[model samples]
Target: MSGGVDSAVAAARAVDAGHEVVGVHLALSRMPGTLRTGSRGCCTIEDSTDAQRAANIIGIPYYVWDFSERFKLDVVDDFIAEYSAGRTPNPCMRCNEKIKFAALLEKAIDLGFDAVCTGHYATIVTDDQGNRELHRASAWAKDQSYVLGVLTAEQLAHSMFPLGETPSKALVRAEAAERGFSVASKPDSHDICFIPDGDTKGWLGERVGIADGAIIDREGNTVGAHEGAHAYTVGQRRGLNLGVPAPDGRPRFVLEVRPKTNEVVVGPKEALAIAEIAGSRYTWAGLPQQHPEESFDCEVQIRAHADPVPAVARIQPTENGDEFVVTPEIALNGVAPGQTAVIYVGTRVLGQFTIDRTVSAVPVGV
Candidate 1:
């Protein structure tokens, strides 16, 4: 629940809908506002207190599952490793995929619950073929379909997102208040659950050892020195010591970050455009696939908050698993590995792939 207002009210609405609910606050090894976890603002004593109180008000049993060991390995370590490898990783998506949907769902099933639920701002709809699909919330501005596009077909079948249909946040709060829930006035967490202040590079450096690397220009000229090659990402514009001059007074962008060579390459903004991305760990959340040997043309969102880019998706064999390659209509701005590339059937999310490799192509217009 994270002691957030949306989750608390979501539990209330579940009960109102005549579904039995259990409140679970994932006690991850990393959360914000607690030095023990090196967290900036979550999973502190305050959050658990709020969760317990909300459960008490909702008349449901609340439990804190000690999944810290699993969380550290699955979410936290994966998060650090991705950055160390010169990629941006969304821990929230990791939390949703590995923790809430997978781990917690398993626990709920073991505990004899018919399904699992969360306060995610997205909806689930069954298609004409009876396949479960993820949909955007009525609250467009607050919709979180992007982060939640990684759910599997089995997971979506028994998952509940009560607030997704609740369009107005104001009305959700009002309904909570009318139910006499104390958390109706609580504020939503704006920062990541673990790294508070959003200093991703700093957090990464603290957890994993840093290595020195060079910042070079497009023509292989050493323009500056960076603390670590992994510290920079595509579309990044700051903290470079490049001595190169821009002919038209245009800004340089991150052209490449070769973690294998510890090289941070910078160049004109035009170099940031990418025509293709390779996805790893592909998963389908709609109809159960007949075989893992599948590929199709679908719109792919290379990362959360990135608008959908029409692309041709193809499945290829990877050393570890299947990889989905997406060739978008236009070159993408920043195609970072370790981020998610969610596939969509227009508005409905059919499946997703974890970014594994990025292919930089010059923007056509540039």
Candidate 2:
């Protein structure tokens, strides 16, 4: 349980189903705060206590597993490395892929647990052949399948989501209240868990010290100077403090962050439209495509809450290896390397790839 209403209610429902359930709260931080900053962060000491209280009410065993070291190495360090490399990464995806499902699930099975159940707003469906597939939850507004897109077929087989069929988060809250869960009205955590204050730029500036860098426009003209290229992300418009404004008096957005040269590239908003994205690192959620070299129709989701876009996906051979590539019918804006592209067929999560390259719809000097 994450000490939130969703998880508490999920635990209660699991118990009501007559299954032996144990609530495990992951201690992801070495130095967690005593109290949450009004839901700005999670995995704090307060959250653990709240989880224990919920477990007590549900009449189940509760344990706080210290995954801080692994979390730092896998999630936190990866975040830093990606940022330092001028790539935008989804830390939640990494946490779900490395820590929660892989690490936690591995330990759970060793301890004789059948599956690791959580309150994630996603579902697992079993096909005719008994092959498990990951799908979006009934609550579309609260769907979290995008973050769990990294789960492989094996992981999905030993995973459970108690709230997957729930119609709405309001219903979950009501159930929690009915069950006398103290966290029934608890606020949901937002922003990065480790950086509770939500100052991502400041947090990164501390670790990857600020370095003077040049901000250039598409024409290779130096438009501004930045304290650090790592502090900026693609599509960011504010805080540029550009020395030169666009010739047409339009606002410029960050188009790329070149860490090798310590440079940030800014350009017209229209230039952010991305036509193609590809990456070598990918995994299927359930079954692999029968014809990997053939392009298949699918919907591609770049962000958690972003609407899925019509696209064609295929695995193509490259010098590096086989790369998963997607070409959206409509150009996707502000796509960046290190972001995950979750491919979906209808409601089922087919697979996901960590984007390493993006081809702009608008060419340079266009």
Candidate 3:
């Protein structure tokens, strides 16, 4: 439980179902000071206390598991490394993949638990062939199946999402209030958990140090100087501070971040259009053999809230392994490397992969 209404109500429902459930809150930060002030923090003392209180109200044991070390190594370090390599990463996906399902689930199973339940707004269902699949939550706006796309079939087998069928956030809060949980009105958490202040660039700058670089236009002319190339992401439009205006009287956007040369490439917004996205580290919630096809059509969600786009997904065999490629019917904007590309067949989540590269139709500037 994340000390929120959703989890509290989820716990209540679990207990009502007559299953032995224990609340486990993960302590992800190494130095969690006082509880954060705004709605940007998670895994803090306040959250844990709220979770414990809810657990007591539900008549179940609760424990705060410290996974700070593993979290830092897996999620934090990976975030830094990806940015340093001129790629953008979704750390939440990493946490779900490495820490929550892999580490925490394994430990829970060892401790004799049949499954680990969470407050995530997603669902796990069995197909007619007895195959487990992940699906979007009934609450479409609050669906978080995109983040949990990294879960393999094995992990999906041992996961539960009680709030998946909850129609709305208000209903969950009502249930929490009905259960007499104090966090019924608690604000939902937002932004990155570790970066409670929601200043990702500032947080990254302090950790990766500064590498002063040039902000260059499409023609390779330096338009401005940047403190670091790693601070910017592809398709970014603001804070470029480019002293030079476009010759064609057009606004500039970040088309690329060249870390090796310590340069940021600026261009017209149209330059961000990408026709193909190639991803590595692919995972499927269903058996690969079940499909028995090299290519399939599916809807691809580039980010958590982004609209799903129609695409043809190809599983290409390479010497290293297999790479998943998505060819959207229309160009996508702001697709960045290291970001997760979640695949869906209707409301069911097929799987996801980490974007490694992209193919753009438009040249640097036109």
Candidate 4:
């Protein structure tokens, strides 16, 4: 339940539906301390107590499953590795893919459970042919289907989201209050669970030690020096420490972070504009029969909260599986490698893949 209002209400609704629901709260960290206040220090001792209280109120079995080792190996290690390789990764998506759906769902089914229910704001629909499809939530502002886009068809079959139709977070909170949940007004967790302070760059620096390297302009002239390339991401501008200014007196942005040479390449903001992106490691919730063709039209979402843009996508079969390329109608900025790119048709989620590279729109020697 994550000790949140949404999950408590989801448990209540599941019980009200007369389905036997067992409340399972994942213990993702080995050393979960009560370091911060509500929602900030999630999965901590206090939060688990709140979840147990809600489960007691709903009159269901509650258990805290320790998945700390698997979570660290799959999600935390992957996050560090991706950052070290000069790519920005969405760890939340990785958690959903590896821990929540794969590990937790597998264990749940083995324990005779039909489905694993979550408080996510997405819907699962069954068509006339009995095929399941994943759709966006009715709550646009609180929709989290983008993170769940990594789910495969098999995973979607045994998943449930009770708050999919809930119109707003306010309504969820109200429902929690109505049901007398202790976490009715608990604030949402905004920062990453492992890094509760939200200093990703600093946290990465501690693990991957600083590698002194030159920060150069687009033309390869050294402008400044940085501790490490892993500390910066594409399109970041605030902390470059570059004393040099562009010839045109315009602000510079991080065009690329090259981990191979430990170089930070800075250029004008326009240099970050990219129109084409190629991705690998694809997973589909459900594929249309006519798809798997050379090319088709779809909406591509580069980030979680970003709007999906109209694009022409090309699909290709690889020895490992399938790789796809997306060409947006309009160029986008800050599209980074190792970040997830989800494909959608109208409101239904088609699939997603990790962005491996991008084709910049800005020409060389411009």
Candidate number with greatest lDDT: 2
Residue-level lDDT tens digits of model 1 in 15-54: 9899878888877764435322222355656778888888
TM-score of each: 0.89, 0.98, 0.96, 0.96
Over the stretch 183-245, how does candidate 4's per-residue lDDT look in tens digits? 999888666788856778888999888989999997899988899899899889898888677
Per-residue lDDT of candidate 2, residues 1-28 (tens digit):
8888888888888888888999999999
Best candidate according to TM-score: 2
Candidate 3 lands at a TM-score of 0.96
Candidate 1 lDDT at 60 equals 95
Model 1: lDDT to the true structure: 0.77
Better of 1 and 2 by TM-score: 2
Q: Count the backbone clashes (under 3 Å) in each candidate.
A: 8, 0, 0, 0
> TM-score of the candidate numbered 4?
0.96
Question: Candidates' lDDT values, in order?
Answer: 0.77, 0.92, 0.87, 0.87
Model 2, position 5: C-alpha lDDT score? 89
Candidate 2: regions farther than 4 A off = 34-36
Candidate 4, residue 12: lDDT:
90
Give every collision pair in model 1: 31-39, 32-39, 32-40, 32-41, 32-42, 33-39, 33-40, 33-41
